[model samples]
Target: MKSIRIDRNRRLRDDPGTGHNRWHPDIEPLIEVAPGEEVLLETRDAADGQVKPHMTFADLAKNDKKVGHPLTGPVFVKGAEPGDILEVEFVDMTPQPYGWTVIRPGVGFLREVFDAEFLAHWHVDGKFARSPQIPGVRIPEGIFMGTAGVAPSHEQMRSWNARETELVSRGGLALLPDPQDAIPASQPIASEGLRTMPPRENGGNADIKQLTRGSKLQLPVSVSGALFSTGDAHYAQGDSECCITAIEMGATAVVRFNLLKGEAVRRKTRFPRFSHPGYFAAPEWAAPHNFVATTGFPIREDGTQECEDLTLAARNAVLEMIALLGERGFSREQAYVICSLAVDLRISNVVDLPNVCVSALLPEAIFER
Candidate 1:
């Protein structure tokens, strides 16, 4: 039951051997902890070491894009081998006093239309966050990771690359080796810099807010020792995460790791699953406030919704939200933050043919009169 803590002083590339941001099988381990030991991890925000409280959009534009989801740790667990279940239990999370939400050009679900970059800053206080600039908007704090998981294996890498490449050849979205326009060859995981931008089977970037304090995420080990790393902490976020960025904040996650040894308990988990000590059924973070819902249909009767894309559908929902908030005199940036923190997306009908509608729900309580 050794308790190990890693902060800004220690990271993957911050050390002599381990890599940074992107995931790979080869990054050296920083600590070797026994099974069922607790680990305290400190992480920088998604802006990698830049984008502080005083930074503007110009400062954000200057951030290095080399590291996709800048995080902490690759602690190698003792006696843990491949195919074992690495139970990452959430003991608690300590977030920084400030947080941010961004809308970058050509990113997120509505890239084409919302092309201009925008930024909104918040005063985070563990329980709630609100921006003085935005006015009358209160975001209830719900801390959970935007990215967390074990590094990928060689076989998993192949599978990932093959699938993404196949999709790209057919004009699908590209996401494998992060879209860094110029990645250095000497950078660790450079040649094989598997982006942590999208979620994968290895559990990278699993942005489910249901992974709050009372839950444990069971990730199947791919490589030896279950080289685990985590970052991209968000104070709160909606389901669709249409804006790309959530309430991005730097937080410390105190996690207890356990190795489910032998062939018995390991058989219970195939994909990543959760174990909650709380109630029977927990929705992704409690939203007790009544919400105004809007339905978005991603089709226009003659197949003009562009390949029936889910991205288009999600964006349509967000657009409807923007319109509603605009009618109430909220700026688009304010509306975007409202969407990230206060809105939730639900699929109304995906099998209805020629039209899939995603409903975006805006919690009425966030608006202060």
Candidate 2:
């Protein structure tokens, strides 16, 4: 099996040749392999080791946001080309000992309300992740990569930039291309590379927990050789990742690649599709036997309602869960992190116009009482 290893004690910046922090077609592949070849890749944490177990919120201010989601490899898969489908089979994942969840300012779904910075340091074992900061709570292991994707073609990159730039001009929340702290920090690649925050046609940062071991993710290929990279492993995460983080950690992921010639074009696939043969999480957690749920609607706090707004409904659902946790003696920050790590948001009803209902379900089994 082919592999790429990195020094865990050092940041990705210290050895930029092994990985990259941005997505650009021109960034050369770290290695090339034939189709159906299996590869093992060791990856850095999402924050590139800037957030440590001993660190507090004070350290967050000094973090370099540009270095977020430092991916391990743009492994070139031979025979994969534009209009083909690249199937990534996640064979296994080995989680590191330490993991963390954070609530940073100007990030997450509830960024406006939970503006304060908070951190939860976890001791991750084989089966569960227990946090010293969150007393009496234990999150079950559901290891998976948080970000994985292929290099976008030059035309795709330019088109994406243009659309995002237009969104920014209209007061949308989009991170534009910035070369500062960028890996492979050379020439136009640094200035034009796409950020790793959102999922696009190339499938970066989908954060789907269901893509665990035995799962296969099919991505629409847009570039030759399908230069694929992956990183930002998570020990566990809620569906919404409401607080914008899970049990974030560095991990070694074992994956194999397969190609479906002309399948993407034949199916008109524009987004990633994934499937898992078995349960993605612990049996009890996957379909929780005991749970508490909160329901929310599009109606705002001021008695006004938006027209079929699922986003507002989800926000309200999570806020309600936070309030419920507060009644159980958890601080707002603690509750937010808990929601991020354990809560599952489901749309109960979307056909109900002007009042789409969303439910936030908290599995009671996670509490170690």
Candidate 3:
């Protein structure tokens, strides 16, 4: 029944942080609370509050991109430990009055297609996010935290970073910079923050738009006290998140924490799960501009993609979307815009290779009714 104020005492690794994009057990808890309590959580934008209302891509490019997605906790829940389920119910999430999206060179699903730098700004009111920058576009309010997680144990950090290092060494990752080159000699490798780019077991940037208010996110505790923190607020986002950026904004949420134990303490390869209880109406899910899309992988019972790639998965989904648009007699540009604004792309499963399906829930509603 206590409140944790979101302030300076919560800062950790990254620029304003002690180091890089990592969360470690050593970072000291900013506040402590027992399970089954509510706290009003405040957060900065994914760019760590760097891009202002009047700022342009040039302004953002000058500022350090490393320090953003500034998370706001390490909130120690009394009696929480590893193998426990940390359930966070987002009672509410409210975005700020402004937001922006950036498409930088060498980033996004279609990076090769559009290699230049682009920025778009939006005016976010209490209800909708509209852009004068992109006339005739209005996005509905479905604000959610793009990143949230508890700290991993030291062993987890080494294993995670080591795997990434292995990938870089094997040239499996082309865009990722070498970690060794990025981290200084003085900082402890285990102490640095985990990269906030990809989704991991500890849940950094899991950008599922369905995880809005009324959604409960269950994460496995790798470290004691379940040092939970969150940032990367998005006012709205398509499923593919193809552009590498969403409508980023600073926001606040009232989170109610609960501990799930017994058989509920399961970790899906370290990835967390988001669920909405009860049969609540989801008009948006089937709205005209939207339709439940299925991405076909057609993998054999015993086959593999042979590559660690979501880009390829996105390609399949986009191709499916293009086909869907063709059915409606829409052009490529029309389909692309609809995908940007309405399509919610989600990986159905990557485990079942050959047919690792990716679903692009098409918002048929994107087209005129």
Q: Pick the candidate with the highest lDDT.
A: 2
Give the deviation of candidate 3 from the true structure as CA RMSD: 5.5
Cα displacement (Å) at residue 147, model 1: 1.1
Write candidate 3's Cα lDDT for 1-369 as tens digits: 454444432333333332224466666676788888787777777766567778877887677556555677768888788888888888888788888877788776766655656677889765668765555556777688998888888888778878887888987752232333232223553235466677778777888877888889988887888888887888877876776788888788778889876323543335687787631564463233335585745432255453435556667677678678767776554345446656776777777655566677765443334
Listed in order, each prediction's TM-score against the native is 0.86, 0.97, 0.79
The per-residue C-alpha lDDT of model 2 at residue 191 equals 93
Each model's backbone clash number:
0, 0, 27
- Model 2 CA lDDT for position 60: 83
Lowest lDDT sum, 10 consecutive residues, model 1, at 10-19
Predicted structure 2, TM vs. truth = 0.97
Better of 2 and 3 by lDDT: 2
Worst-scoring 10-residue span by lDDT in model 2: 280-289
Considering only N, C-alpha and C atoms within 3 Å, which residue pairs clash in candidate 2?
A: none
lDDT (C-alpha, whole model) for all candidates: 0.74, 0.91, 0.68
Q: Evaluated with TM-score, which candidate comes out highest? A: 2
How far in Å is the alpha carbon of 159 misplaced in model 3?
0.8
lDDT of 3 at 12: 30
